[model samples]
Target chain A: MDTAQVFGALNIIGLFVFAVSGALTALRNDMDIFGVAMIAFVTGVGGGTIRDVLLGSFPVWWIAAPSAVFICLAGAVAATLAQPLIASRLKTLIWADAMGLSVFAVLGAQAALAAEAPAVIAIFMGAVTATFGGVVRDVLLNEPPLILKQDIYATAALIGAGVYVGLMALGLGISPSAVVAALVTFAIRAVAIIFNIPSPKFARPRKTEL
Target chain B: MDTAQVFGALNIIGLFVFAVSGALTALRNDMDIFGVAMIAFVTGVGGGTIRDVLLGSFPVWWIAAPSAVFICLAGAVAATLAQPLIASRLKTLIWADAMGLSVFAVLGAQAALAAEAPAVIAIFMGAVTATFGGVVRDVLLNEPPLILKQDIYATAALIGAGVYVGLMALGLGISPSAVVAALVTFAIRAVAIIFNIPSPKFARPRKTEL
Candidate 1:
């Protein structure tokens, strides 16, 4: 497959995994089937939609690609059917999320570069694309966002996007650059998951007396 | 003021009040000054930004209008300074929030109509525009979303948007339609607040035995 085809396939994979994760969250929350589908669809598209809007990409990406919506629904259905099997396999789901994060970080940065955004903005968009879907899902479920609470999630995406931008600036081919950057993102997340690293927290001052 | 200028002024008011509400939420959560400002800015712009994105309006509104950023910051600062006074008077803040919600509901539907979206979509966009900012703020703060829990919040926005759209379809002028719709929205919210009406909840089935 050519570069476009490869990236397109990876994007579908990202959408499907994100949808499964969202459906799982909805099921855990005892949401009805319709709510599960809605959450899954939102989680699948939310990040990329946000990135496209920020970059001023018209009509958003998914509008022209109805297949993406179908993929998300398929993921939701699959997850629902496999709920019992997956319930005890949280680690596997986390790993799948890492895959989605890594791929989307590179794709998001590529999109920004295509849109001629500044490198800094591209990197930020990469992190946003990789993380915001989960953020929206958590918010809808009234759970603390894993993006804010987890170790090395958005940070890993940011570093990976930075690496991809640096490589492109150095004249690396797009395919190789994307592969290296995605791998870097996955490695960082994997390490964090394995070591159970804690995210840094800022110290807040105590409430002052009135 | 002409119609554009009148709507412009009301939009600014909406932004300022939303920012104040966000800043208040941040303060209650014991966030630092910078965090307060960030939340205020997000709350001020989040709903409109979402509306613009979904409508494929490029660059979002705030990027072209730097004044909006400054207004949000000003609101944050004002709220921070007046924290004690506002804390003692929650009713006033609620009324101010109602004003913002009413204005935004009309404006959001107007934007969608301008984009030539279907009437149903326009009305839904109106609700999205009025409530998503608070949804975002509550999510960021790990609180239950008022949009989901509060009485007649998004419903008021939806009905108001429907009124505006319906009036416009019947050949009413923009200014008059906007005014009538916003008043209707505000009246609904005010009634809900006064009566302490409860939001409708869907009855969920009990967990099935494994």
Candidate 2:
């Protein structure tokens, strides 16, 4: 398959996984079926929507291609039905989410390039596209945003996007570049997950006595 | 002043108020200055950005008009410095917020119309413009979205947007239509704030014994 085909297939998979994660979060929060679907749609598509908006891509990707919407809805329903099994395998879920993030980061950069965005903006778009959906989900669930909580998540996305953009600039084939980028992201995130690597935290200021 | 001039002046005030609200929320959450500025910018411009993106307007309004950005940043700084006084004057804050909502709804609809969006789409855009900023603010602050909660806030926006659209369809001049619509929104929200009106909520479903 060509780069476009490969990216298309991986993007669909990423969307499904992200949707499932969103549904799972919604279910954990005791949301009803509609809420589950809403969260799933938001989590699966929110990042891309933000990226597209910033790039001035109108109608948004999902609206132009309803297949993504269908996939997300299906994934949410499947997740709702299999919540017990999925929730029990926390490690498996995290791995799947990492894979989704990796794929999304590469795809986001490609989309930005297509939009003729600058390299920095493209990288930023990639990171936002990869992770902002989860941020939206966490926000709706009234949880601290995982990105801001220092899981090394956004950093992973930034590195992945940077790698992809840099390789493309060097005249590397898109497919190979994307593959390398995705692998780098997934590997870094997996290592972080396994090692429980804590991101650096700021020291809290001491309270002064009046 | 013409309708455009009036809208321009009110829009700046709306942006400032919205930015102040966002900055105050960030301050309460103990975020740093950057976070305060980020939140303020998002809350001030997020709604219009969403609307413009959906309509396929390029570069976004804030990017095209740096004045908005400057206003929001200044508002955030001012809010940060005046936190104590602003926080103490809760009633005044609410009144300002109501005014912002009123102006945003009308302006949002006008923007949609300028983009040649269909009437229904314009109305929806208006509501999104009026309320999505607060949604962004609440989400960032890890609070349940106020629009989805009580107080009839979204309802007020919808009514105002609808009234404006309906008036325009009836061949009412833009300025008069906007004035009537803004008044309607402000009146409804003000009454709700004064009377402590509670939006109807659905009763929780009984848990079935498995």
Candidate 3:
């Protein structure tokens, strides 16, 4: 497979996990079925959609394919239907979300490169496409976005993108470059979670000189 | 002014409006003082920040100057201090918002042109920059965005950008072209509000046969 195809596969896999994570979040928040579906849809496509739309991508990347929508639906439905059984065992969802965040970050940077965007732009796109979906999800749930919280979500994605840039600068092949980036992101998120890296709780402003 | 200076002026003016509008939104939503400031900051810069960051225009446009941050702070402070007086004139907020929207749309497009972007991208950028801030505000408020609401807000902005493009195609000078576009946008938005023009709303999905 070409490098693009490899990244495409990773993107699809990431979409699935993001969608599932969104659905499970909705269910936990006690939203209705439509809300669950909406959250899933938004989270799955949110990052890439923002990237493409701003890049002036015609027809939008996801609109060109039924596969994206279909997978999101399947994941949402599965999460919604299986919430009762799976809520008891939360480890799977957490792991899936972490993996998806990594994969999405890698694929996002690759897509930016493929679009012939500048390196700085590619790295920013990677982080935005990786983390903004979860931000939307959390904001919609009335929680502080994961980024604003103490979680290393956006930070992990950014560091991964930096690695990707470094590898490319070294004249490494795209295949190895992408894989290395994804692995770096995955490791950051996993290690952070395992070590109980906690997000800062949303707080009111304290007394200060203004 | 030089071409770049003109673009610079439009950007700062647009940011001013956006910041003020965001503060007003927070006030209307009954947010805390800090919450209001945060909302104002985000709403004022959110859309353009998204546009520039994704486009790799770092350290994003506002980071170049302390002015954008100052404006946001100023707006928030004014709004907070003027809450009683502002509250008494809640009826005027819509007009203020509409005016801000129109100015921002034209400014966004003009900036894109100055940057030598394609006509289509410039047009989209106008709408994106004007609308996305409100979208973030509404989403945070758990309301469907104004864009998806029954109004001609986006349509007005879109037409204004087209007008700007048309003027340029007709070999009009940049100053005249910009003036015409801004006038057109303001007129469209004003007419919509005065005449109560409404866009169609999204309906719930209809049931289908299995």
Candidate 4:
């Protein structure tokens, strides 16, 4: 497949996986079925929607493409049906989330580049796209955002986006660059998960006086 | 002043109060100075930004209007400086938040109507605009969202938006309709707060079998 076609396919996978992750979270929180679908839909599209708005892409990608909405609903249903068989929902969620994060990071940067944003903004958009969906889901569920508290999550997306942008700038082919970047991001996340690393923090003490 | 000019003035007040509320939350969470500013800025413009994006208004409102950014930062600074003097931060925040929510609910509905959205969508947008900023703030701080948990918050916005739309449909003038709607919203919220009313809940038992 050509670069655009391959990226399009990966994007679908990312959306589906993100939806499942969101649905799982909603189920864990005891939300109703409609709430599950709504959370899944937002988690599937939240990051890219934010990026598109910032980049001045009007109507967003999903408004014109109703299939994306169906895909999210389907993911939510699948997650709900499979809940009983899943041996470890938390582990499944983490791995599925890692995949979604990696794919969206590259695609988000690519989109920003297409929109002619500066390199730095494109990189920022990449991380935004990769993380904001989960952020929205967590926010709605009243949970601490994994992006803020987890080890090497947004950082992995940033590095992945940087890798894609840097490679493209050096005249690398889009498909290979995208593949390499996504894999690198997943690897970083996997390592973090396996080793149970904590996200880095500044040394400044919390101000109790405020 | 004309309706548009009056609404513009109220919009600035809404933004400022929302920023102060966000800054106070960040301060309570013990976030650093920059974190305070970031949360304040997002809480100031996030709802309108989302509205503009969904309505296909390119670049969102704040990108073209840099003054909003400065206003939010000023609010953050003002809140930080005034922290010691404010005898009851929680009370101040609730009142400030009520003002922001009232103004934005009317404005959001008006914007959606201007964008030619259906009446139902416009009302939904009103609630989204009035509540989403606080939702974002609470999410970042890992707190339960006030909109979902507080009494009559989103309900007040929805009713206010409906009133605005209904009045305009009945040939009421913009300024009077807007003022009436905002006042009604604030009154509902005030009553709920004063009486310590709880949000309505469905009688459905929690689904533990998921």
- Candidate 3 residue lDDT tens string, A86-200: 6452576677678778887877777777777677667767776787777787777775454443356666887888789779879998988988889999998888778967432
Steric clash pairs (candidate 3): A150-A200
- Comparison by DockQ, 3 against 4, better one: 4
- Encode model 1's per-residue lDDT on A1-210: one tens digit a residue: 677886887799899999988877666666545456656877888899999877778777765566776788898888788866543435555776788899889999999999999999999999999998888888887866778667889999999999999999999988889889999999999999999887666875668932
Which CAPRI tier for candidate 2? incorrect
Model 2 pairs whose backbones collide: none
Task: Output the better candidate (1/3) by TM-score.
Answer: 1
Candidate 1 structure quality by residue, lDDT tens digits, B1-210: 678987998799999999988888888899998999999999999999988877788689999999998999998999888877654535655776788899999999999888877786677678778878877888888777766555677678888999999999999999999999999999999998999875443333234422
Residue-level lDDT of model 4, residues B1-210, one tens digit each, is 998798988789889999999999999999999999999999999889878878898778999899999999998999999999999888888888899999999999999889777786677678778878888888788877766556677778888888999999999999999999999999988998999875543232244442
Candidate 3: residue B78 lDDT (0-100): 69
Residue B181 of model 4, lDDT score: 95
The TM-score of predicted model 3 comes to: 0.58
lDDT (tens digit, per residue) of candidate 3 on B1-210 = 765676567666666666676776665544544445556766777777666754556445653354666777786776556655543423344565666677677767766776788999988888877777777766655555767753788888888888988898899987777778877888988888788876656875768832
iRMSD, all candidates: 5.8, 6.3, 9.9, 5.5
What are the DockQ scores of the candidates, in order?
Answer: 0.14, 0.13, 0.08, 0.16
Q: Could you list the chain B TM-scores for each candidate?
A: 0.92, 0.90, 0.84, 0.94
What is the C-alpha local distance difference test score of candidate 2? 0.80
- Model 4 reaches what TM-score against the true structure? 0.61
Evaluate residue B209 in candidate 1 and report its C-alpha lDDT on the 0 to 100 scale: 24
* Candidate 4, superposed: residue stretches over 4 Å from native: A195-210, B1-49, B58-127, B130-143, B147-210
lDDT of 2 by residue, A82-182 (tens): 86765474565576678889999999999988877778667767887898888888877876875554356777887899999999999999999999999
What share of the reference contacts survives in each candidate?
Answer: 0.20, 0.18, 0.03, 0.24
